[model samples]
Target: MPKRIMFTMGDIACAEGAISAGCRYFGGYPITPATEIAEWMARRMPEVGGAYVQYEDEIASITSVIGASWTGTKAMTATSGPGVSLMMEAVGLAVMTETPLVLVNIMRGGPSTGQPTRGQQGDVMQAKWGSHGDYQIIALTPASVQEMFDETIRAFNLSERYRVPVFLLADETVGHMRERLVIPDEKDIKLEYRKLPTVDPSEYLPFKPDDDLVPPMALLGTKYQFYATGLTHDERGYPSDKEEVQIELITRLNNKILKNADKIVEVEEFMLDDAEIAVIAYGTPSRSAKRAIKDVRQEGIRAGLLRLKTVWPFPERHVVDLATKVKQIIVAEQNLGQIYYMVKAAASPTPVHLMTKPAGMPQLPQEIVQMIREVHSS
Candidate 1:
């Protein structure tokens, strides 16, 4: 049996998870709700032969992680809303250059540091489309400290497997809550390393897509002499202003993720087989959703809960399937209908209701049960 350990906050579990995942480089600036993640990494990195550097700002911090990743090191960074805003450009750079890195955003109130220490899921949409471009980003939301450890490890593995930056999206409550987590042994977990070029340096093409749709990566100090840029480029990594090359490059970038979305999307279902009403939620709100479902079930509502572990690359197929079976779908999120819209779009013709509270506090179980009662009455 696995031993269960208690954690005071989710950020500590995230730090422990990254370290266990073989992350050796951490570059970040201090920010509220997420500052503890950096502090934990700083204190623990040296003990694990890793390095932690507090950058001058968020932009530099994210850029430094990208640079470290390009040098064949597993790198990560953590920040809050305002800091994530500052790191958007560097995130775009990571996408364009195909840098495999993990970014943890312990979300607080947004729109210019609205509430630095308060909880909010307002960054859900931002994580998907924060950067200025047409690209696919993987974002995972954890509802508990146990998930903070498991999901952070998954984020790094997905980043390395897909050659893209991955987001570990957590809010203040989930980032700060204490829970008993079962830490896995090192030998049981499988870690995916980046694929290196098998051909000689002279014949290597940096951006050449392989059979797996992921291009082989070459480290900066390696014998391979190839260039990398953000602009639309060919397989040789040279910038091209041609419309055809631009189209192909952008299409490949988007499809590489979309085509393999089944391997990326993850969710947890509870008592869904015979449920008449279903609750859709993610992050901290999902915890309330789970409890609310139990409350409604005790009241003989035949309700179930669908908790999203992967927020981005939305689980449309699963949502549609559940919608077809359930009479009503209730979406409870910290934000005011960000993911609710996607759920509605996927479950067309099925009545979808929203139970949202964006006041920097998580939705309560009673609040969700009340919404379900209102829906059933109507």
Candidate 2:
């Protein structure tokens, strides 16, 4: 039987999840709402024979995690809004180089230091487009401490399997809340590592993609003498100025995740089958949405909750399908209206009601309930 334990904060559970998922390397700088993750890793990594380092800044921290990941170790880092902004360049590097690493962003208000210790989901759009380029990123959002534990493992697995960087996008309330988490045993969990070329160094080409469009990664000091460059390159990892090679490389980079979106997307539905009003949300706001739905149901209103777990490849198709059945869709988010537009676009003809609070705090259940009532009356 799996052991169940109560955690006081989501950051603690996230750290524990990384450890359980075989992450042996952690590099990060301390920041609000997410500092506990780095602190926990600092104390726990030593006991597990893993390495944890608090770098001078977020740039160095993310780059170090990428470096460690290339050495055949599962590596990860955690940060909040401003820290994530600082790591954007490194995130672009990871995507261009196809580095399998995990980044946990416990989001707070931002543009630049909007809120240090407060809660907000303003980084939803940033996670998708912060890095400059047409590359695809896999980002997951967790609503509770238990999800923080579970989704960290999934983020790592997706990073390794897809041979790309993945993001665990959490916010303040979810990062600080305590909940009972049932962690799975090692045998019960399926872990994936990047595929390595079987051929000798002389015959190996690092950027040459396999059948799955994922190239086997080579270690820096290994027998392989391959090069990794930010510029467009062919199968041999050399910098090529050829337009065709550039197109193919960019297409493959974007399509690898885009084509396999079904495998990467995850969401939860509550009373969606018969619900006339659908409440769409993620992270901490999702918890409030669930509560709001329960309250509305008690009042004989046919309401439901659609909690998104995978936020990057935004569950557009699922939202579209759900829209056909619901009379109105209410999006409750900590941000003003980041995902609200996506849900609206997905729902098309179906009306989308926005219930957003841009303040540095979690959306209250009462506020969500009020939004639902207003939408119902309208």
Candidate 3:
């Protein structure tokens, strides 16, 4: 009710944040690193007059959340890489139907459950491309326990406002680590709900977009009687087979987010005012990069960090702007180099270098500082 402060793990904080954001339904399957989210939801949902259902598998869990959302409930699910694999088809379904929901991914070492107890950032690209199709989704990478609490609430608000699935991407390191979290008072927190249709049920068009290119959603069990499907549909929510209809529908789906990227993207810059070498990182690796930058700064290296809080709209504008001022950009991630290519593409001819770590390992700050030194000398 009032401001609550405590030391908590990221996963537990995520569950509490969802409750704070007014989420009333949670449907998920337990998996490594992310299981605590479901466990906490199971215990807390009933206490909050909400429902938590543990389905047979991740596919059912995702689909259940989709169904619960149509009933005018703020619904979400949590999973890891393997569970995400099973939810891809339904992810596409949520996209086609324009369902507003949240998907929290507490990533573990993977490629087939590579290391359940270990952490990794290997799911960066998967969050963007796990589901097939030309679609856009918002993904947030929280670097600390405090961020885990704060970003989960933001994820729900974005999903509701945009009518798209938002991903809260965290790895095992962040998910399991305990740290201080401050929960603001209820009245102080900002919340957003889906825009409901103003028109009568007889005149409702479920897929009709306003000027913002986002449709006003009508709830199930209401006077509004409309159809929805994974198939390409017209503004009236009826199935359409025309090529023009396909293009029109798909284009709007992608553009709603892409056109708004400037507003949705968030990046934090540290010591970049006159830096010659820049570092870009996100999630757990961003923590390491911050420390690395501080170490290099003490050694007379003009280095800074560009930490990504919103990973999906990819923050190309920031990267491009950084390239104009910095001599080189170094990308550090706990993967084979997924985001490195993205940085290289955005900062072309700006000499982007990468420092990578394999799964089950941390990107040490000392190693990152060494890389900065090498780039400074070269």
Candidate 4:
């Protein structure tokens, strides 16, 4: 069989990927570096019998998605840093209700509306910690146009599989880049839908979980009179403020992702078998890290790369193991060390170093190479 490849922009690939993954509805307000995703969905969704609505604000945009998800439809939204800030409350709502949702944050520079057109990965921690209260989230970072398409599908699958909001945390660099992407046949795409209630709807408890800590979903118009709220809820989905109920609900939410971290998170290990130095990175910077790793190797440095495909759940075990094996680790990002402390904490005693560039553009391969040499010499 001949290999098939298509040339397209990353944002277009992402919107198409969502459609292919059965995303039937997308509700979002337009924002820079992310508006292309919304525009693509607007043009494409109707042809596929899906729905795309440009809401008045990011808050409503995300709220509408939560409502649509309850109808048993695969739904999503796209936004950047400021919009993500607007959606934080709804994000907490999704978590409290255990709603299966997907959000694409095409991150750009931001303290407050900073550099709308440029790329920056300042949201490295926000994607995981933005929502209030304690809960787990699945966030995938794509370093290339291909992974933007590929990981969007994976985001939907994992979102349904875990009944948590999954995120495709793409930076502006990858979101705007034009590249070749091999579109796989529909049959080749592995799709996982939300698990339905097996028993009669009368026997259903909306917040009740099966063995894996994931509750089966029943659509809104179904026979079940399903109820859910952002407030702390019981197994029956009615709001409960009891101390024990709070503990059980929150504990289960945290454990579902943490206990199953091995299954839910993925990281790439490149040329690290006998490497004395390791470079850890994700999102667009990982692209540069790959380049630096190759070039550093040419200069007789046994440097390896650990590219995070799944940024959340932290991949602590992988970092810890590599820490024990390597003499030093370099944490690189497009922001001023947002994820650097995470690496330092996880790679304790490995003397992790930080290389960060704030806004404007992604960290270049040459910049990373210089840092690698400095760390190697030190």
lDDT of 2 by residue, 162-245 (tens): 889999999888898888877776678777788887898899989988877889888878888888887888899899999899
Q: What TM-scores do the predictions have? A: 0.98, 0.96, 0.99, 0.98
RMSD of 2: 1.5
Residues 16-56, model 1: lDDT tens digits: 88987899999999999999999999999999888999999
Best by lDDT: 3
Global lDDT of each candidate: 0.90, 0.90, 0.93, 0.91
Q: What lDDT, from 0 to 1, does candidate 2 have?
A: 0.90
Which parts of model 1 have CA positions greater than 4 angstroms off?
Answer: 1-4
The worst-scoring run of ten residues by lDDT in candidate 3 lies at: 356-365
Superposition TM-score, candidate 3 onto the true structure: 0.99
lDDT, candidate 3, at 229? 95
Q: List the candidate numbers ranked by TM-score, top first.
A: 3, 4, 1, 2
| Model 2: residue 147 alpha-carbon error in angstroms | 0.7
lDDT of 2 at 311: 88
**Which candidate has the highest TM-score of all?**
3
As a TM-score, model 4 comes out at 0.98
Model 3 alpha-carbon drift over 4 Å, by segment? none
The collision pairs in model 2 are none
Please give the distance, in angstroms, between residue 210's alpha carbon in candidate 2 and its true position after superposition. Answer: 2.4
